[model samples]
Structure formats: structure tokens, C-alpha cells
Target: MTDVPFTRTETPVLEPITMINAFTVPVEESERFLRRWKSNAEIMAGKPGFVRARLHQSLINGAELRYVNVAHWESGAQLEEAQKDPEWYANTLQMLNDPELHIQARPSIYEVVVEVEPGARLLP
Candidate 1:
């Protein structure tokens, strides 16, 4: 009889939710939007249930969707609470209302149905 010399780590299974926001901005105003976006991101990062966030930029110049933000939260409630932070709200309002930026945003929360990683086998 032989025993494996390894220990398995146990982690809680999470039904996490994702917050995705797609933004349309003029090419010229991208910098301004990014600056304000960074500030807003910082506020979310400090909130509870925030797992992580990534902002993606489109390769095409002057694309309709200039930037897309994808963030993960432990629960929808936590994400909603974080978004209510006064500083974040003010920053978001200012950024969106800035005529120079002319940004349009489509934001929503989603639940992941399935995920496939590279080199992973499909289940039967």
C-alpha cells in the first residue's frame, strides 16, 4: 500500500456574477474617458466582493465600442452597493455628462453559463 504525498486545497464554490460595460467614445476623447474610468475603477476595487476588473480596447480605430470593461463580483448585491458609493457615482456622472467626451455606455450584470479554458477537454 502506498499513499500519495500531496494535499488538495479546498475552496468554496462561488456563483459569481460579472458586470460588463461597453462604452462608445470618440477616438479623440479616449484619453479623457480613460482618466475618469481609472478613478472609477479605483473606487470599485476598494469595495467588498470585487474580484477583479479588466478594460479592453478595440483594435479598430474609432470603433463604436471604444472600450469594454469586465468586472467580477461575488454577488449582485455587493456590486450594486459598490456602485452606490458617492465618489464613484459623482465620477461616473461627470464622465458621462461631459460633452467633450460624448461617451455612451451600455452596462449590465450577467451570470456565466459555461466557460472553456484552453487545452481543456469537453465533457460528454
Candidate 2:
């Protein structure tokens, strides 16, 4: 009898939840903060428990763009824990130098109740 060197095995790890939040910026501030915004996104992507994210810029002629940051985590606890790091504060400060950028933001937490199966539909 011999044992295989490699075999399929399952190990349990903390599975996190998906969090979606939107950041609304004034129309006048977009140009001033574009670089800072990209940098912040890159920083968050490098954090632990990060899954994926997308930043959406609004298309409305005169409306400010809303940057939606979505991330999947192992748990709400993990998300909350990682956010307490003081490094987050340093990175966040870089985002505030732009005078045009409104310091105020509207963010919300959501728990997904149901999800529909994915479909392949292209927008026109």
C-alpha cells in the first residue's frame, strides 16, 4: 500500500460577507481627487480579506460621481477588526487634502437576504 503525495483536501477558513458602500463626491471635486481616489482603492485592495471591488463614476450630466466600494470578507468581525488599524488613518488622510472634496459622505451597511442566479446579459 502506498500513499499519494498530493491529494485533494478541504480545510475550513473564515468566510466573510459582502459589503457595498457608496462614496458621493461633488461634481467640482472629481478632477481634483481622481488620483487620490485611485490610490485609496489600491490600498484597500492590498488589505487582508479583500475579494474584489469596482469604482463607478456617475454619468449624469451634472451629478457628482458616486464611487461604490464593494468588498467580500470572511466575516463582519474580520472587516471590523482590520479597519481598526492605524494605517487606515494615514491612507485616509491623503484623501482629504483636496479642498473641493466634501469631507461628508453617505455610507450604509447591508445584509444580503437573497441573490438571484447570474445571467449573461449585455447592456445596449
Candidate 3:
């Protein structure tokens, strides 16, 4: 096969902020936690810099961590702004103060180094 030269197009890269939250919830209270979590997600989705949010549940029958939340924001400042909102604060406090659910959240922020798209060629 002969190599053909193709013009490469470069698009602006986005350095969006990412938040990962690991949650350990009691098996029996998983549904209730999901409901509350969804409501919280909706509130975040309405924020200015919010990109998207996803919640993942462990498929293992007896895993230590029950759920993991991954959310994307335009920047860390935007995430902080969302957290400062009254509704967001209230919902967070409610989740933290709830006794029946026994929910624990371990949250952290991250920055992307590189991203590859399917069917896209990498140019040197």
C-alpha cells in the first residue's frame, strides 16, 4: 500500500475540569440515594459551566463502593460557583446529614492531559 499525504485539521482543545465522587451507600438505600443524587445532578446541570454528569454503580454483589459520580465542568472556579449556590448547598447538607442512607462521599478534581477521539488520526 502507498502512503497518501492528507491535510491535518487541528481543533481547539478544551481543558475542562472533572470531578469524581465515590460513594458508599447501603444496599437497601441505593434507590433512595440515586433519587436524591439525580435531583442534585439536575441542579448542577442548570449551572453555567456544567457540561455533564454521570453516576456509575458497581455490578459486584458485595463491592465496598456502591456508586461513583463523574461530572465535568468548564473549570474549577465554575464548580466552586455551583457549590456555593443556596440550593446546591442545601442539597449537599441534606445528603450529609441523612442518617438512614449512610452515604459517604469522597470527591476529587482532575485535569485532562490528552484526549483521543475514535476514527480521528493523530498528527505528529
Instruction: Provide the global lDDT of candidate 2 against the true structure.
Output: 0.57
> Pairing residues by index, what is the TM-score of model 3?
0.78
Tell me which of candidates 1 and 3 scores higher on TM-score. 1
On lDDT, the stronger of 1 and 3 is 1
Off by over 4 Å in 3: 1-15, 114-124
Please provide, for model 3 over 1-124, each residue's C-alpha lDDT reduced to its tens digit, 9 standing for 90 to 100.
0122211122123457788888888899988888889888888999988999989999984777889999988877778767777887677667666666777777778777778899877786
Model 2 misplaced regions, further than 4 Å: 1-15, 118-124
The pairs that clash in candidate 1 are none
Q: Estimate each model's TM-score.
A: 0.82, 0.66, 0.78
- Tens digits of per-residue lDDT, candidate 1, 1-124, equal 0122212122233567888888988898889899989988998899999999999999998689989999988987777667667787777777777767777787877888878999988787
Model 1 — which ten-residue stretch has the worst lDDT? 1-10
Cα error, residue 67 of model 2, in Å, equals 2.6
Best TM-score among the predictions, by candidate number? 1
For 2-101, candidate 2 gives per-residue lDDT tens digits of 1222111121235556666556667766776567767766766777776676666667745543566666766566566655556664555656644456
